[model samples]
Target: MNGGTSTTTATPNPSTTAPSAPKTSKPGRTSPPNSNSPPATATAPSSASTPTPPTASARSGGRTEHAVSPRLPHGASYTLLALGAALAAAALSFTALAAQFDNNVYDWLFRVHPAGHRPHEAVLLAFDDRTLMDHGGVRGLRRTLASTLEILAAAPPRVTAVDLTLADPGDPAEDARLAAAMLRLPGLALAAEMLPDSSGWQDPRPEFLAAAEAIGHVHALPGPLDEINRMIALERAAGRDRRFALALEAHRLALGGGAIVSTPSDLESGGVRIPSRQDAGRPLRVHYRPSSTVETLPIGALLADPARARALRGRVVFIGVTALSAIPDRLFTPLSPLDGNRPMAGVEIHAQSFETITNRSFIVDAPPIIPVALAFALAAALAAAFTFTSAPVAYSLGLVLLVAAHTLPWLAFLGRLVLPPFAPVAASWSALAACAAFRFFYVRRQLASSEQTTARYQQAFHFVAHEMRTPLTAIQGSSEIISRYNLPEDKRKQMGQMINAESKRLAQMITTFLDVERLSAGQMDLRSSSFPVSGLLDACLRRAQPLADRKHISLEATAADDLAATADRELLEYALYNLLTNAIKYSPEHTTVRVSATRDAHHHLLAVTDQGMGMTPEEVKNLGRKFYRTERAERAGIQGTGIGLSIVRQIVDLHGGRLSVESAPDQGSTFTIALPA
Candidate 1:
């Protein structure tokens, strides 16, 4: 009983609502309320209240008014941002390149804090040419050294390191004399050299070794890339025996020669874990004293000035060759205060290394992952910056990130940490630029689409004005005739009839305009029901008959009365009426506009064929565009806004149907609407 009531109510509702539905939908699809005018093929005016976002219609490589404009999906924007970040992250993983920039930064820092300005406790007693000349050159070096050792024993210094490879044997008597002198001083140390291939060692003579308090290797390895001596290995292998570097050994002896903790990769003195080169070898970064900080005097000068010799008491003294002509032993270093091109003597380098270890001053290099992680962080920041901000703001953020890149590393360097500065800065700016460019192009395309839409609206407005002018003039002229003259009853009645017809024509055009707008916005709800095709065709013929009679064109329908269609009857009637009217309007007198309905395999086809001035291939191709008009129609003074076919197509699409036209110049045209049965 409830279902019967619901069905009965629904049946009446559609019929009662059918006429009123066109009041809103068709008016929006055709024209507005105040517009009771004919449309020269006019289209619906866009709603002022509803804003349309700009979008691209097609990617034609060139702009065309007919192409659709649609907004870019958010997914594509996100994908571009991710792509930029991934590329940046990939580039940052090359640690070697980043490390090179770090090395350069360190060089600059060393320049700012040059060596030799600060006072150093350790002193250099170099065996220069002056000492050599006094002792008769190399031949008398052993005797001179033996004499110096005896003087050092009389007024013993805290510690004395002989930074020389005393591997070569000398006269037995001279060796014995040097050995006796060395035994007198309990704080004496001798230097040894490791073989280049780490196979063996060049130790001091057996007599000298027996006398010395400690022995350590004097070999220093330069940096792998720049070949500058910036660090020193704490331990080196000599055959099966491990040898400490000269600096480590000297520091140990200075600390009262305690039991040293040593390993292949690390060393410890006084409970201090020695900071050394990581991964490659156990090389420790040297904390250098200024070249002038360690006061140097020739051995002859120290021997000549007894008072000066007394000042060396309780000081750690390193004795090595400094004269270029004699030993010529010097190498460039990062900590070179005076000249980059000139080398600091080898002995000075060893002295600085010893100072570094004894003072526990070390530089810490961040782990390899630090740079890679920072690179990703910077990339993500740039991505977010672009995402949240406009192009100009994002660019400003990029500048800030660039500054941070260099600043952070510099601060870390000051804190005794080695952080790479190159990759993070480069990646941040690159990612920013890529995202910015994508955004710029996207905005440009959107603006172009908006402009095209505006142009379309402007054309639609003009079309409405042009279309309404004709009927408005006719209505005014006919109304004036009926009012001004006292004509015969039949003549006045005829003039009055003309006014009513013109008014109705104007009203229908407005309705058609509004219908298009509503349908396009998907606001038109179809009142679907099964109805005979003949009924729809009969209504269209009745409406188009007046226009057909004016043109003296024949209007015929060949649809079977029982051939039915399931669709919005009123909307379909409006569509068919438009086709019939257009055919009558464009065709010459005595032409026939045939309306027919036939069923095929899957669809019932509603076709309107005319033998009028047909369109060419190009005109047919562009027939469905809003506000389009053919040049042939224009020449023949035919009235149309060119949007009739556009409305027809939209109506067909709403019904899940298709509309197609076949035409050629001078051959007339056929328009078919295929609706599923």
Candidate 2:
């Protein structure tokens, strides 16, 4: 109704998808036959042009000629339309930009991020050469104790979260300096060291806990199975109390909570129940910044460096050390550079988690039902539109549909559209494209069939014409020789024999040609009647006797006494005759050519095996093509029309049988016809 996107709603028939009404068109359509006078119909095929269409009907219902099993009921169009609309709607809804994005499947969408954009307030604690040279090396804090409290007071930030651990409680002044910093910053939180409670002892640092406004157990986020970080959990226990996770707490602190958050009964349903979180979540989707190489900044640079430090004022600063000390617990984020090294501390990861929660952006997957409906609708629409058009246009439309399906995922990349990339769109487009290709090629084949029929007729005509010339010329020459000159009795008899031989060759050639023509036209109607199987071999053996005698080749028949099959008599006879003739023709002089028919409990087989100058597989392959002779045979000067076995195959097929040949150069071929007994 609205530019091909309908808005009508109907209750889905839960029982079935097949719609009901008067038939309109089939699932896939084909055109009616061609337009020629006399009009081709299944009945009276020969007299009524075989390749032509019937006169158009007066129904005047805008019908197109198509070859399909059956038509879809006209009433079902609304159902098809409804399904299509639903698909389009679902794609738009879950795919939109402002929708709740799932951080879980983000790396699936984006694999590599360039230099990320960091706009959040975060501080860096650089272990400078000055601090290192003051003491010794890695553990330089043992000497001169500097107060972090002074640093926190100087930089005005909403939150002061430290990443370091006071592993050694012996340095009382150093511990005191950190504690003093916690009291000065009202929103300051310390990353607490986790002690395994296996011994049932709680080692709580009262002074540090008392000074800090909030204490978060320092724990890192898990990376993807492939070491990629796409998501962070926002809801978790801070410590003993069921308090908000550090990220959640940070977000709540920034947005100013309306009510203490409570667990809903549906926390398992992947929904976060936080009060007045709209603002905090709106700005947390930060572009990432790599912490190594060019992205590295010393602690002094964050505090003393003007450009970045100016940007950090009034924003909450979460300070943490970026080190790869996995002998201890680490902040295992997805985007670390040290060969998939997990983030070492949880404090900085909490900053990332807070940033994501505040931004309120996530990825969403469209419903499964949407794409399924989409594919069916797309396939149906393409089939409908091209049902009446020429092949080229239908093919072009198919390609367009294919391209459209391929381009679908790009919407998610550029404009945040989560369309189906796997089953429905891809699968349906492929099906449509296949339909288009098959239909187009099938029509072209039918046209070619008509032309081939004409060509076959032309070739048969010339074959007959050429055969007549040989015998007619011989007869004329023989008569002239008799009339124009005196000849001895023996010489006259020889000339008569010459004329007789050519005439006989002409007859066999003509009969064979006619036999094939009838078979090709599909007019050689068979009269199915049960017959004695050995009767067939017995008949062909007698027919092949003369040809065998000419080369002194033995034509032998061996068969089990009784085998039965219900099939046409003449068709079977023709097939066996061709096999016998080839055996005699290809075998060398005096070679035995065996003709046998046997029946096992399951099936009956008719086999012809020849011994002599056997053929290569290439020769056997060309044996069925009209006018095609094997190169070796032509060189050997064997002569006959080339379509004998082609006719044989047609006859075998009519009997629901298979014909197989086995041969190699110099090894005789065994041709076997297998059929149900």
Q: Highest lDDT: which candidate?
A: 1
Predicted structure with the largest TM-score when compared to the true one: 1
Candidate 1, residue 468: how far the Cα is off, in Å: 6.0
Candidate 1 residue lDDT tens string, 311-402: 77888889888877877557777756455456778888888887777666777777767766776677677677777777788789877876
Worst 10 residues of 2 by lDDT: 43-52
Q: Report the Cα lDDT for residue 17, model 2.
A: 33
Residue-level error in angstroms, candidate 1, position 448: 3.3
Candidate 1 TM-score to native: 0.70
- The residue-level lDDT of candidate 2 at 371 comes to 56
The TM-scores, one per candidate, come to 0.70, 0.47
Tens-digit lDDT track for model 2 on 555-588?
Answer: 6666655466787666677677778878878888
